[model samples]
Target: MAWYYVENNESVGPVQESDLHALSQQGKITAQTMVCRQGDTAWVPFAQAFAPGSAAVAVADPAGAPRVSHSCVMCQKSVTADDAVQLSGNWVCATCKPLYLQKLKEGATISGVRRYAGFWIRVGAKIIDSLILMMVTIPFQFIATALIPGANDPKAIGAVIALAVVTNGFNILSNLAYQVFFLGKYAATPGKMVCKIKVIRSNGAAVTYGRATGRYFAEILSGLTLGIGYLMVAFDEEKRGLHDRICDTRVIYKD
Candidate 1:
């Protein structure tokens, strides 16, 4: 029989049942994805429809009107759309609505489907960022040195000291601005983008400029601890570094 599935809250297609099974195996259709066969009056979950010896069940409203059931994005319970609330484009049944709202208020990832980035991958991204920063700072260092009087005079200790301080300050501010702007606006630096990962809040929301600034400072704690903070990702259940834990952030794969 031909089958149809819901994707991104829209009905997808009338493909052969074999094709539907292929989609499910390929991870294109999740167990909770709504599916219906041709001429079916109601939609049911892929698991319910395909379970061994199970048949798709049609639900009817109390007033005897035909109704379609959807899986709650939070609790995974079958609920008719009329009885469920939509939050951020995902469905939550009446039973889970309160808990879902509480999670939202507390800034937690409601669905918990994020794939945390591992330490090695994070290190790779950091290396890339460092290289980019080096490229930017090297030129600025040359320009600053050329502009400063007596910069090339080995005897001018005070002038050399002043140049060093100015150069270091510029590097610090530039690094901060780079991280804050990218994390706040794109949720990833160019390095993280190349690595296909991004930083987000524990709630799965994009990082804000203020939070990004704080997180950049928090990373200093990671460095101060002799890199133990970053090492935490290798052992932590959520793959969180010290900065991630301190800032309540996560590094997760984009896909």
Candidate 2:
């Protein structure tokens, strides 16, 4: 039984078998610990017994100089240290957090960092979709408030109520139907399809309902600024519209 520190991927161990078991049960040691006994070529977990002083080794260097340790996950992206992210054992630069997160959300394990959707494409898509929703709703509103007068009239109120209910329900139906069936199933809407674009997970996995819901609500943010925020996609690095970023989605080539 013993204890070891697994920093930077190297293990220093062989404390005491009883101590190791106690640490394991106390949650100090994990199954991933690489403990090994003296004269053993292979490493085992903390649960195994090992000779004291067996884990320490002379970390060799090319020039016998102090090694400038490089990050296990990537370059100088010290995420957990400087930033308050505290994501995991690895570190990442602030600029790379979103990119790394997107890959993670999509079920991809990327070492270091990789780019995902940028601010523009995510925002812009949201703006456009919200506008489309508004366009769809305007007619319904007009018909409910203006065209149908005396909405409070008992005799005709029922009809007006029915119309309003149907109209209100349409937005929800459209959102669910279009997103689940068209976006999820076909990967695009009429406009997106026509533009030869498709929405996909950053890791290229199938879209899920939760992600689609995020995209759906993100439309409101884009609409908040009359779609100016959405139009910002034209200048974004990833060409992401607002909604795309909000949903952690990307619009890419259809093919």
Candidate 3:
């Protein structure tokens, strides 16, 4: 008996040869019916291919219309109807699609539950680190003012330039160094280390620099509006900090 494999709105003939005969004998298929074979990329039938619940077809649509949806690639969340968010060539649920893409753009790993440092501790450490950075920056700012000639003119441009050269750079560097060195080595920042907390990737891996930046920026968004955003963490399923959802990151327990 000749067999056919159903694939991509089309049918190709002579699949496994034996599989078709077996299906035919079992009454699971008929000459005018459509079915699929094992080890085949898709389902095919004597007439057309049918996905999981579309079996008892009453009409000969012949087009093998795809009325159902596939699961999401990242969260594996199912999407049934047409209104679902389609991302990365798969059907992703509404709540997860935006989040998943946010992380992907930032290159976050986003795998499983992870440990995170307490909010207060992180805030405090950033303060101390920023202070130290300021100390290092003031001297450099004076040097820059003398070197740039117009750097002292407080017209916003020069001031902004001076700030970027001195304070802003140092501040950013300080935070980067603090998070990367601490989190990479101990899975915690100085504050997190002191607070006995740590940040972890969703998959139990050490948080990477890229993901850390995403989460940190998300923190900025969460804090820009009177801290109402941070409160969203308490309501989240994984207890995500504002940064977690945006970064596709999470904080979990070390022990």
Number of the top lDDT candidate: 1
Instruction: Score each candidate by Cα lDDT.
Output: 0.84, 0.57, 0.58
Backbone clash numbers for all candidates listed: 0, 20, 12
Clashing pairs in 1: none
Candidate 2: tens digits of C-alpha lDDT, residues 1-255: 234444346544546657666767887667655554332323454433333765544333322121233232434532223232434423555566687668779977474333333444444554676677778777776767665666656679776787678677877777666766667677776556555567777545667766776777786688687986577666665566677667767667544
In model 3, which range of ten residues has the least summed lDDT? 35-44
Top-scoring candidate (TM-score):
1
Residue range 1-255, candidate 3, lDDT tens digits: 344434455454555666665766886557655543422224334544433566534333335633344455556654444336754323556667787778768867565323244455556655765665567667876776676656667775966576566756766666666666766677666555554566765544577777776666677788886886677655665656667677666655454
Instruction: List the candidate 1 regions with Cα displacement exceeding 4 Å.
Output: 1-112
Model 2 CA lDDT for position 2: 33
